[model samples]
Structures are given as structure tokens and as C-alpha cells.
Target: MIKTTRIPKLYVYQKVIIVFAALIIPVYFVNLLMNMKGQSFIKQEFSDSIQSKAQFYSNQLDDQISFIRNQQLQVVNDSDLQKLNFLSGTLDVFEEIQLVNRVKERLSTIQNSSDYLLNTGVYMKSFGRTISTQSGINKLPNQEYEIIGKLYSNSNKSSIYYQGGRLFFIEAANNSSVIVYLELSVKKLEKTLDQLVGNYGYSGAFITNEDFSYYISSKHDDSIVRKIQDNVSVEQSNKNDDSHILKFGDQSYRITYNHISTLGLSLYSYMNQNELTGSLKTFNIWLLVMSLVSVVIIIVFSFSVKLMIHNPLKELIAAFRTLETDNLDILIRPKNDIEFGYLYRSFDKMIDKLRQSIRQNYEQKMALQHSELKQLQSQIKPHFLYNGFFNIYMMCKAKDYETVATLAQKLGSYYQFVTRSGADEVPFDMEYRHAMDYVEIQRIRFSNRIHVVAGEIPDACKHLMVPRLILQPIIENTFEHAFENERKGGNIHITVTYEKKSLYICVEDDGNKLTDERLQALQKKLANCSIVLEKTGIINVCRRIQLEYGKPSGVFVSRSEHGGLKAEVIIHFNYGGGSDV
Candidate 1:
């Protein structure tokens, strides 16, 4: 053996270098391959997007051409153009031109500027008479003679033909009297096509006739023209193949063809492959750099994995162990390393889960309490119904026919108020009416022994929303508790007033003073801590207000200034002067 020491440092260096090279090399090549694949995918996707856009534009253009043609046919059938042609005695060309100008102006107003069409004109076969304001007298074609002859032979059907290198003839209703043509300029159409191509990063466009004899190119490329013309034998053949990618003179391109039958032309949009792959190339360069960086990070982290990951995990485990013995207030601290930060966050999430569990438990308990409270409320309604029906039965049994009839009617009305259909909210005036009805019935029972006083309730509060039967129970409680056994005259006063986000209803009775124990018991019931169902009318009122309007409402019982029991109900009023209770 050649001088072997305790630990071999060269082995460690060799392993590190080997690991570094192994990580970086694959990262570079894999990044390059991925870049190429991504670029190819992007190019194909971009070409497809462009092809779809061209096809949509082509269809729209075709519809516009057909619409213009139909409109021209209607103009040709117009009796005015025929009348102008049939008129004798030295034709007034000036007035006729003026009328044509007016018609052209009106048509121009309706046609979109991007549509590439001009005015509809009438051409007469006899004497080569033409009425066109779009084409001036100087711009009139000398070939108008042959064009009119062709018009008379074709009759009143629509046809399309190219003329004068700049204009497209959209001829409709070619008859003996007139040939109506909607002139669309090729320059405008070319501009529109160019705009469409530019929007989709396309380089050029080519338009060809049905027979492929004539063609116009946006880029003036003769090779593209020859290639497309040779490939498409007929107009129908153009529709068979919509898209293709071709290589032309060291450049790759994607061409999408749309056959427009309405205009008798085929549109081909040629896009450069470079434009589609441009963004992909940028993304590949970024990905290559990122991948290389990731590989370096992975290798560095692999060797340092124990120091970076294991130490923090141990610390987190120790902190978690402490949680078993300690309260929920245990604090966890992680190391400065990024890998350790992740573990720290995980620990924090665990603690958060524990806290959330405790909160959920509390919420469940509260929900159970709420459910029990609702069941109690449901029971109260049936109890009231039973008592009301029993009272009616007793009156009927006593054979007091008049009192039974009146009481039955009042009871029916009271039940109707209690069990009214619709929303939970009722008008404040309705609640007041119900309270007054209950007091009237109590007045009959108590005779002149009880005196009731109600203050002026505002008309504006008539439509203001409040809970049904909210005030009635409080007033009924006053009569039952204060005036029930009082021999002397008892007075009950009801006053309602609005005071800054709350509605205050004061029900005071001048009767026997309540002992401190009774007052405390009443307060407990109002606060919802007491479970006395018989005394729950006040509790029901409090609970309903709390449920409907939340914590801002309840009943308050104290000694009255008039030397008796005084009950005050505070209900929260919402923003629109309506009691949520």
C-alpha cells in the first residue's frame, strides 16, 4: 500500500466533484431538450391560434359581402332607379347624379369603415349609362360597355368579379334595366387582412379568385402566390385543407386558408414560424438557467442535508415533546436555515390545528345550547296555543254567549297576529295594534281596576319593521303581575321613543312593590341564566331579541318612580329606522 493515512481527504474531494459534475451536466442537457420541446409545442399552438382567427375573420367578411350584395339587389329593384332610366326628353344627369349621391351617402353612413365596401351603384346596359357617386365621372371604367353587356346576360342574380386592380365588383340583380354593384376596394380589404395578420403575428396574406387565375398578396410574394395557386385547383379545394406548415427559402411558415364563397375569393394567412417560437426561446433560456441553479442547489443541499434538515427536525421534535407536559403556551423556535424554516412552519400549523380544535369544540357546545334554546322556543308557541284554546273552551262551557263570541273573535284575531304568514318582520304599528288588542281584553277582565295609558305613536313608525308580538307580551305581563291582585286602582303606562340606534319601550305599573329577591329573580330570567319556563314570557322576549338583533337587546326590571315594578325593553334599531327584533 502506498502511504495510507487515517482518513482519505482525496476521496471526499473526488466524491464532491463527481457529485457536482453529475448534477450540473444532466441539468444542462435536460434543460436544452426541454427547451426544444417547449419551443416546438409553442410554435404549433401559435399556428393553430392564428389559423382559427383567420377562419373567423374570413367568415365575418363573407357575411358582410353577402349582406351588401342583398342590399344592392334591393336597390336595383327600386322603382326610382327604373324611373330614371325610363324617363325621356333629354335626361337631367345633374339631378340624377344628385339623387345617386344622396343614396351613396346614406349607404356610406350604414357601412362600417372596416368593412372595405363603398356605395351601391346602378349600371344600365343601353348606351352604357352608369349612376355611381363613389366612382367619379373621370374614374368611370371604359370597360363599362362590356360590363353592362355581361350584366344584361347574367340577369338579377349576384356575382363577384375583380376589376381595375383596385376594385372588386359585387354585382347583384343584373337585368335589362340595371346592374347594381357594391364596389369594395382591394386596397381597403388588403389593409384589413394585413391588420388581421399583424394581430396574430402573421407575415402575409394572399387572396385568389375561384379559378386561381388571378391573385393578390399582402407581401407581394410571387413564390407564395404560385405555390397556393398551384395547390388549390378550385374554390372548393381550398376548404378541404385549412392549415399547413411549409418551409420556403430557409424560413418556415404556417399558412391558413379560408374560402369565402360570398366574395368569390380564398384568403390565405401566412405566418412566420420564428414569431411563434420567439417567446418559447426566451422561456427555454430562463428554464435552462433555473434548472442549472436547481441542480447546484440540490447537490449542495444533499451534502448539507443532515446539518440543514436533521438538526431542525430534532429541535421541532424536542419542542413537540415539551408540548405534552406544558400548556398550550409553549413557544417553538427554528434555526435560521431555510429547510428548518419549513419544519418550523409545519410545527406552527400543528399548534394552529390544536387551537382550532379547541375553538371548534367551543363552537359545538354553543351550537348545542342554541339548538336547545330554539326547541324551548318552539315548545312555548304550543303552550300559548293550548292556554288560549283552553280559555275559549271555558267561556263556551259557562254559556256566556255574548262574552264567548267576543272572546272567541278576539282570541282568533290574536292567534292570527301570532301565526301570521310572511317574513319574520312586522310593522311597528301592527305590533302596537296587537298590544292594544291584548290590553283591551285585559281591560274587560280587570274592569275599571286597571287603567292603561298609551303615548302618541308616530305614523312614520307604521311601516318600520319590528318582531311580531314583541310588545304584547310585556304589556300582558304588566296586567298579570301588577294589577292581578291589586284592589286599589292600578295604572300601566306604555311609552315608546327612539334614542340613537336603539328603540326604548317603557312599561311602568303603579302596584305593589316587588321584593329584592323577586327583582333579582326577574333580572336572572331576563339575562337568560334562569331556566324557569313558567316565567319565560320575559325570557322569550329577551331571547328572540338577542337572536334577531344580537346582544344589544333584553328586558330590565327595576323599581319604578311611581313606587312599583318598572320594566324597560331596549331593542336595537338598524340603519333604516327598523327594529331588527
Candidate 2:
């Protein structure tokens, strides 16, 4: 029986919910997406209809305005009006009076012909006199007279003006200084605007030119009108006639604007947003209710399944609990459920034998792994001793007593650290200091040929209890193998840093002469989880880190930024006891 680690996976009930959700979620979202798309189409169609209606009304008003303007033109050139103006001095007061009455009759006839017309006025420039159908034959220099004269000059050939809350059209005579002005019925224009927005729950419509000098409207809600003016920009309607939506007072509005080229004004049609999408909103609510029903069904089905499987699953859990207590000899009798009975019967045969084999195998395997880890850690004694004594012999032969003294001190301290027993983990600062001692020994041996750049241990990580002999072996491997053939420019650097619950140690070298294939092979050795069986110092350190911390906490090797080998060691403090280091 092989001992394997158990990773908690999804349970059957969880899978059931996931499967049902997977089946229902697409239909839910598909219906939602369809509703969204349909709302878009419906709004577009509604906007198109309003756009066409606006255009139709604008053209109709344009034709009416043009007809009124034409009638005013005809009266300007009428023979009776010409006599009333240039020939008024030659006629007697009675004859002039008859001419005035005749012109008044013509104006009255024109004003009464159209429902949109208000009143017409004739300015008699030659005598400073004016005549009108509303206030017939008023004397010269009156308020209406002065207003007509001012309006005639300020019309600026634009043919129209607004004053005193009324829209007016002014046309001058062809052969005289006389002018004829027409006042359009603002009330009538307001009625047209009102008709455009008839019966809306909350709505308004209005007509405005570039001047906005006169906004003809049926309602007097200034706030809504001002909001519409600010939010709706109709300058782009010549290119695309898409209507816009506006939010006001907890209500959304659909606003449409169409430019009237003939009258030089724009008509804006406003209505409640829900007025157009009431049906779709109802449909969306229905879909939401149905989707909730589906979720409720799924939840109810999950409870039903739990109830159906609860007893059998309880029995199976009890059986597993007996195994948990190492009571594998406690056999579970078959239950009434056929499938569960089959499982119980099958497991009963294997439980006892499996229990005995697993206990023996697990104990042996753990003992072998722990023994291998200890051997790797303690193997530092023999190889390091041989090297230390040989280096001391070389210094003695060179007659360098000063160098010999320094080497002896470093060697004694380095061995004193490695030869200690019982403590498998030491403070990180101790490990760091011991690793430095090994580097100092190498420094004395190689003299000016090796430059080891090392950083101080961070204060926060100094108290961490880490596995013994972890950092020294990697540094030794670097010095022994990487700088083996190099005589100059040999460099070694070690660093320490921590993130969250993890400690990172990186050792790098610049004197490495490793080929790509050999480097790759070495990297693969460090990454492999199985015991390497090879007793190389770097590989042993890699295995030791893996044994202490679990997966994803180990040694990794890559090419360094300095064109050499870089080895990184990662240990998780959660697994490697934080208090112990």
C-alpha cells in the first residue's frame, strides 16, 4: 500500500449545484440578452417614428408660415396700398380715409383666412401714420408705430423677429418706405406643440429657432424645458437622427429633435421613457420572476437530493471515521442501499489488510526520508574537514603565518557550527554568520582572486528559525565548482529577503563556466521531488528545503543577470515552524 496525500476536492452536492447552474444560467442570460436587444430595437423604432412625425409637423408649419409670408408680400405690392403710401398727399382726407379703410379691409380678409394668423399692421411711412386690422387707423408716432419702425430696421433682412412674447414677420415695401408686419398667433403655435405630445403621463414639446428668442410651448414647466435644452444636442441630427434619453425627478424621458430647414427652427418631442418600453419592462419583470423560480427549483432539488443521500452518506462517513481511528478491523455491514452495500462489502475485505500494510510502509518511508535529510545536513563534517586541513597545510608550506592564523580561526568556527548535533534548525542570523565564516575562509584561500559581495541580514528576518547548514552548502558549491578553473574576476553574491510567510535566499556566481546543457541538467536535479541519491551539496540543500517545507517551496536555478548561475531557495515559515526558524 502506497501512502498518498489527500487534497480536499469538491463534494457531490457541490457538483450537483454546479451542473444545474450550468444548465440554467445560459437560458437565463440568453433571455436577458434577448430582452436587452429587443429593447434596443423597440427604442430605435419608436425614435424613428417620432423623427418622422417631427419632420412632418415641421414641414406643415413651414408651408403655413410660407403662405402667410406670401400673403403679406401680396398686400405690400397691392395698388390700393401704394396709393395709400406715395399718393396720400394728393388725395383729400376723405379719399385717403377711403384708401385706408380699403387697405384695412384687405388686411382683415388676410388675417381671418388662416387660423395661425393673429393681426396685421401697415406702417404709413410717408405721413408717420399706421393702420391695422386689430386697432384700425391708429395715429402716427404711437407705441405700435414706433415698434413697427424699429422692428423693420432691425429685421436685418432676416424677415422675422420676436417681441413681447410673440413671433412677428416684417416685410418692407418695394417702391416706398412703407412696411407691412404680420404677428403669428403664439397660442396657435403652442397648440401645435401640445398636439405633438398629447396624453403623455409626464411630457412636454416645444419649437425653438437658433435665437431661442421665442419658445412656443403648451406647458409652462420651465425646469423640464431647461433640462431638455441642456441635455439634448441636435446639431448632429443632420447626420444621424437618433433620439436621446434624459433622467429627471426619478423619471427617464425620451427626447427627439428634428431640424426644420424651411423655418430655421427645431422641434423637440419629449415623452416618458416608460411610455415606450412599458411592455418590455413587464416582460423583463416576468423573466426575472421565472429566473428566480428556476433558482428556487434548483435549491429545492438540492435539498431533496441531500435528504435522499443523507442516510447512506452518513453510514459511509461512519465507516471512514472508524478507519480514521485506526480501527480497520471494525467491519461495516452492508446497508439496504444496493450501491452503498456493494461499496461497504468491497471496502470491508480490503480495510484490515490495507491497514496493516499502510502502517508498516508509512513508518518505513518516513524513517528513510528523515534519515536521508539528516545525512545530507550532517554530511558537512567530513568533506569540509578534509578541505580545511588541506588549506592549512598549503598555508604552512607558503610560510604565511598571518594567513594561517586567520584560516585557522575561520575553520575552527565553521566546524564548530557544522559539528554541533541535536539542533536541526538554528536562528537565521546564526546561519548567516556561519555562511559568512565559510566565505571568509574562501577569501583567505583565494586572496585577491575572489570577490564575494554579501548583504547584511534584514533585522525582521534575523529571528526566524531555519534549517541548519542551508546557506553554507550553496556558497561552498559555488566556490568549489563555479570558481574551480577561474584565476581572476571570480565573484559570489548572497542575498536574503522575506515576503508574507516566505523566506527567500539567493546565491549567485559570476565565475561560472557551465554549458547550457549542464546548467539545464543541474536545474532539473534541483527541481525533482524524488530523493536525488547524489550527495552533491547543492542538491542536498534543495532536498532538505523540500523536506521541511511542502511543494512550491524549494530550490530553483536560472541564469543570473550577471551571465552566470543563479539559485533561489524558498521556505515557507508556516510549514517550517516560525518560532523554531
In terms of lDDT, the best-performing candidate is 2
Return the TM-score for candidate 2, rounded to 2 decimals: 0.43
Cα lDDT tens digits for candidate 1, 102-215: 555544543544356754455654424565555533223556435644543554444765544644454434354456666676777777777777754447887877666666
Instruction: Superpose all Cα atoms of candidate 1 onto the true structure and report the RMSD in Å to 1 decimal.
Output: 19.1
lDDT (10s digit) by residue, model 2, range 80-157: 998877886888999987888789888998898788888898887785678887777777778786777777666667
Candidate 2, residue 484: the lDDT equals 67
RMSD of 2: 15.3
Residue pairs of candidate 2 with colliding backbone atoms: 464-581, 465-580, 465-581, 466-581
Model 2 residue runs over 4 Å out of place are: 1-34, 92-102, 154-157, 174-176, 211-214, 220-242, 245-253, 272-279, 293-581
At residue 5, candidate 1 shows an lDDT of 69
Q: Which residue pairs in candidate 1 collide?
A: 155-174, 467-581
Residue ranges of candidate 1 with Cα displaced over 4 Å: 1-41, 87-115, 125-128, 135-158, 170-175, 199-202, 233-240, 302-581
